[model samples]
Every structure is written in C-alpha cells, then in structure tokens.
Target: EPEVTQTPSHQVTQMGQEVILRCVPISNHLYFYWYRQILGQKVEFLVSFYNNEISEKSEIFDDQFSVERPDGSNFTLKIRSTKLEDSAMYFCASRSQTSSYEQYFGPGTRLTVT
Candidate 1:
C-alpha cells in the first residue's frame, strides 16, 4: 500500500512571505488535491489537478495560491504571500482512477503565519 507524504510537517512564516508546501502522492494515483483545515473549522478544498492541468479550484484558491506537479511524482502548493488568516493544517490528497473514490491524505503541513 502507498500513501501521500508531506514535508516540513510544521512551517512558520512571516506575513506577506512566500511559502511552498510539498507533497509526494502515491505513484499510481491520477487525481491530486489540496485542502486546508483552519483549526476548528471544517476542511476546505483549495484545488485539484489532473492530467498536468488544474481540474477544479475553490474560491479560497485565489491569485496568491498555485499548484503544480514539478516532477513526475511531486505535487506542490505555493502561497505567494502568506497571510495571518492562512494559518492552518494544509493537507495533500490523491485518488486513483477507480470507482472507489477513496482519497489518501498526507499527515499534513501545518502553516502558521504571524
């Protein structure tokens, strides 16, 4: 079995600074996504990528945010300018092409902006 993995489990940044969260999804997965949980709030979908392009994105994924597959196996989310409100647990998820619809999630990268 394989799973998603993230780096810099915890990240602290200054407001207006840029930060990049990295994720390596299962090798065989086809769909990838980025989500965030703001402490006590529900998980919010940020963006999804497929076939080397963005498949969908939520309003929360604004101009400041971008996602890319920098390599064959690595998926990354970049926050151009960190904001205090961006503090949260950012999760990386991936799913296969099967009908199961089961998404494997990474432990998550906690981003704290001050």
Candidate 2:
C-alpha cells in the first residue's frame, strides 16, 4: 500500500532562518493538504491545494509560508522566515476523489524553531 512520506522527522532551526519540509504524498491521490499541531494542541489546517491552486487556507497560512508541487510526486512546504512560535509537527495529507473527505496523514515533520 502507498503512504505519505515526510523527510527530516525533526529539525532545529534559528528563529530567523528558512526551512523547507518535504513530503511525498500517496501516488494516486488528487487532493493535498498541510496541517500543523503545537505540542499539546489540536491539528490545525494550514492549506489545501488541488489543480495547482489553493482550494482553502486558514488564517495561520500567512505570507511567510508557501507550498509547491515541485514534481509529480513531491510536495514541499517552505517557510521563508521562521519564528519561535513556528515550532510544531507539520503533517502532509492526501485524499482521492473516491474518498475526498477522508485523509491519510504522513508521520509528520517536527520543526523546532529556537
């Protein structure tokens, strides 16, 4: 079975630097999403993309964040300028048309901004 894969399970970065979190979503899915969770908080949706445009984005997805499908299989999230509050577990998810509302999440990329 195919699954979402994330790189650099944990990362520590300076407060003003940049970071790129990578993900390989399930091979046959059409919809993709990014979500983040603070240490003890609920998962908060960041953005959802389909057909190369953003379908929806939460208030948390500010100008500092961007996402791209660099290729057929790779999806990436880039934070242009990191802040201490940016520390969290970033999750990548995908769902196919057959099951658009049910999402399968990656193990997650834990980013530590200090």
Candidate 3:
C-alpha cells in the first residue's frame, strides 16, 4: 500500500518568516491538494494542483502562498511570509487514478506562528 508522507511534523516560527512544508508521493494519483485546520476551526481547502498547475484554490491561497513539485515524487507548499493567523495543521491529500472518487490524506504537519 502507498501513502503520503510529510516532513517537519511540527514547526514553530516567528511572524514574517518564510516556511516550506513537504509531502511525498502517492503513486498513480492524478490530483493533489492542501487543506488546513486552525485550532478549533473546521478544515478548509487551500489549494489543489493537477498537471503541474493549480486546478482550484480558495481565497486563503493568496499571494503569500505557492505550491511546487521540485521532483516528481514530492510536493511542497511554501508560505512567503508567516502571520499569527497562519498557525494551523496543514494536510496533504491525493485522489487515486480510480473511479472510487476518494481522496487519501497524510497525517498533517502542525504550524505554529507567533
């Protein structure tokens, strides 16, 4: 079985600093996504990438954010400047190349911004 893997399981940063969070491959998946949950808040979709371009994005993914696949097997999300409001648990997810219409998620990386 295959699953997504994220690095820097926990992060603490000061406001205005940059941050890059990473996740690994989910073989045969055609779509990838990033979502976040602020403490005590509902999970919210941030962005979705497919074919090396953004397929969809929420207002949250503004000028401060970007996504990349520096290598075919890994995907990353970069935040240009952190803000206190940016603190949250970020999750990476993917949908397989099947008809089930299901999306699998990685455990998540928690970001704490001061």
lDDT of 2 at 34: 95
Every candidate's lDDT: 0.96, 0.94, 0.93
Which candidate has the top score in lDDT? Answer: 1
Candidate 2 local lDDT, residue 11 = 91
**What are the TM-scores, per candidate, against the unseen true structure?**
0.97, 0.96, 0.96
Tell me the spans in candidate 1 whose CA falls farther than 4 Å from its real position. Answer: none
Give per-residue CA lDDT, model 1, range 1-114, as digits (tens): 688999989999999999999999989999999999999999999999999999999999999999999999999999999999999999999999973989999999999999
| Candidate 2 lDDT for residue 67 | 94
Q: Per-residue alpha-carbon lDDT of model 2 for 30-53, expressed as tens digits?
A: 899999999999999999989887
lDDT of 3 by residue, 1-114 (tens): 889888889999999999999988587887899999999999999999999999999999999999998887889999999999999999999887674978889989999999
Error (Å) of candidate 3 at residue 15 is: 0.6
Which numbered prediction scores highest in TM-score against the true structure? 1
Clashing pairs in 2: none
Measured with C-alpha atoms, the lDDT of residue 11 in candidate 3 is 92
